[model samples]
Target: MRLQTAVLLALTLLVGAGVADRALAWPPDLMPADALPLKVALRAEAPAPKAKVSPVTGPAAACCAVLELRQYTLKPGQRDALIDLFDRYFRTGQEAAGLRVVGQFRDLDDPDRFVWLRGFPDMSARATGLAAFYGGPVWQAYREAANATMLDSDNVLLLRPAIAGSGFADVTPVPPPVMPSPAPLPPAPLPPGAPPAGHGMLVATLYYPFPAHDAAAAQDLADAFARDGAPVLVAAGGPVLAAFVTNPEPNNFPRLPVREGEAVFITFQAFADAAAYDRYRAHVGTPWWRGHVLKGAPEVRRLAPTSGSRWQGPF
Candidate 1:
């Protein structure tokens, strides 16, 4: 597990865009023509069935039981500028405001795009933390600068750990000045088109969508991934960091839009660079165990680091 959760929350600032651009389409190499159907309707039915909430309770798992997967499409060439501001100022202020800033990154395929994760102890904490940060002085001071770096900030997914032991590894905190300078991490000798692998670690986020109507199946699928699918991915080549199932908890703070009908199991894997990711892909689907465990192919999103990205700790 990695401790990228708390720093991301501060990066979500006050902004208004009529609409945000959707994530770049899944990569061609990853999305096969005969692959399992990838699209699901985004809206849940009215009078939506209540999503069950199961908050992880304990001292060790203090952050990120409930998380948000946030992606922002920045104005061309403005992604790094945002990351600089986030690392130097926003992350510290966000923590002070009581929000968890999970990990943040640059999208592998889209240079102008950024993605990050945020966590909450529970839904109520989410409301309070967000309210405190959004209404507090930190955001008010930097709102314009932060808003200017973006084109849209609306793409977000509310998620939870797929199973026990499914949160980020606790990385030691590196204060802004003491952290390493913004240089692309050395690339592992991976080939082109794998996840980006230059400055920092690359994370491959696999999204496995279940039938919108089958809530039980969604949990079952997540369970199966934890028991069977994860090992296969590791055996093939992925060094998995963590995996999570989408929480059914309705978004208490409706101010930020969430995907209503979608249900997915998400997995994270770290690679030295695109080449390492490609190596994992080479062995991923061909295994016999895959046919036994996976019911369908998943939608994949690979993220790499911007100059400002950081992943610390034992993980």
Candidate 2:
């Protein structure tokens, strides 16, 4: 669910604005919309991944039992302002409302795109939590200022860990009591050369399989990643921080709509730097799962976390 409401919910996205500016091998299509086997949201059928790892323990272990992967499209040059307001005012308030702040990020490839993750213990918690946050004082005070800086905020995905031990770790479920007074608007940018925000190296690889031919095919591919692909990912450079599959649950909060009918296997990884990420990219020239999946490669996002994000990487 969105941490804050957009002030301008009625505005439509400019075609030349974002989604299309990115190159291929990205989601929502860098190629023509019809090129990929996974079209718009459709029923995705896959079993729980069989491969198991130790469950990730943190303050919000159950908080991330279900998750929201939100990507926002901002007006020109408004990204940083939104980031400032978001980093300063969003997390703690949302968490206090019984939701969890997972991580917040800047889409390294898209200047106008803001990506983030938040979660709840389960579907019931999600409904109760979202009602509290959106209906609470913090959002009401800053909603307009926060909304003024946006063009869109509806690109969202509902997800859960693909297997045990594959959800984000170190998430804080709530913050100590504090007032909702927002800091002055248009907050300052980080000092030049201050230690970069959390290594600034998170990559999300999203897999969109062709509609499941067999009930087991999708799960088989996910299982293959655990058995065969994850090990190679760690050895080459980055470590797989978490892995997620589409949360098949019905949308509990109708206020924020997630991408529907879409089945995706998303993985989060951390690298030392772009050089480290590039090295792994080059190493995967012949992907570990190349001959395994019938569909082409998945889309990738090179994301840098905001200063306030707890997911500052190397996790």
Candidate 3:
């Protein structure tokens, strides 16, 4: 997978592996009055001639160009209840309705937050699938239990892959092992053909209104990073797997909200372990662009994948 976005920050900000440097020039303020327009969304490519795969797998995932990056704020101590409800009951039912549960995770930085990704073939499928799943028997039956675990569920980002052929459509999903009942015991053994459950960490970085630069400057910066920054990240021991940008299209499914009117670019990376991630930080001395290029620092989340993910990148 290719993280097609966040080229600017990940590539530029190597200084200290995070945090802004407070001693640099603010370039955007010096620009001419007009803010040049930037092409925030990547162009969509034509599809291949293969037969459509229902419950799309790998190559068929291109069907789901539109994605939802949802982060929920849960009430303290309610995280386990929500995960149990989701792992056992929600995954299959949602898939059955034509949407894909791309992956789910526990935010290592914040124990009270749950993060998940949902995919749709397109905006139309998004509306259709969401309506069905939310109105279907499963959600109707368990909605109460699911809702009880959260204090807020509206922190969602509507996004799409940043480059051609770099979408989640390339991620092959495995059959999630669901519990027979909502019990606290460990999950049963994996059936044949499933990848062995493994351990690792995923880091997500967000570039939101990377303050100061005009649209044109931001786009130029992003392009530069895509070409030069990837190798730097790899050299630092973090393999960024996916890149995404905000979907400018209006929210067709108004019933479920998404973060609108905000400029966001994101990158997802995989690390072998916590220690490996630490080494990566030490390798990249401070990012030279931190204080000079972006006024506001991007948000980074170190994530732990949940077992119920239909797909969790190459990890």
Q: Which candidate is the best by TM-score?
A: 2
Ten contiguous residues minimizing lDDT sum, candidate 3:
15-24
lDDT of 2: 0.64
- Predicted model with the maximum lDDT: 2
Query: Candidate 2 on 1-315: residue-level lDDT in tens?
Result: 110111011000110111112221211212335554322211154322221111123222323689889989999888877777777777877877767777888888998998999877789989988887887777886788789888888888898866554566546547643435543344345444432354457788888777733324555556667766765665565566677788888898898888887677777877667887898887765676787655567878889888788676533
Worst 10 residues of 1 by lDDT: 10-19
Reference-based lDDT, residue 32, model 3: 32
Where model 1 places Cα greater than 4 Å from the true spot, the runs are 1-62, 171-199, 287-297, 307-315
**After TM-score superposition, what is the CA distance of residue 239 in candidate 1 from its true location, in Å?**
1.5
Tens-place lDDT per residue, model 1, 1-315, is 111121111111000000011112222223447765232212333232221111111112224678888888899977766776666556656666566676677777888888887777688988877776666666666677778989988877888866554555432232332222242232233233323223535464554544553546666665655555655665565655556677788988887787766776676666667787788788888542353334466656677654333342112
Q: Report the C-alpha lDDT of model 3 over 198-289, residue by residue, as the tens digit.
A: 25677888775444424444444445556666557755767655567777788988988887767666777766667888899899776523
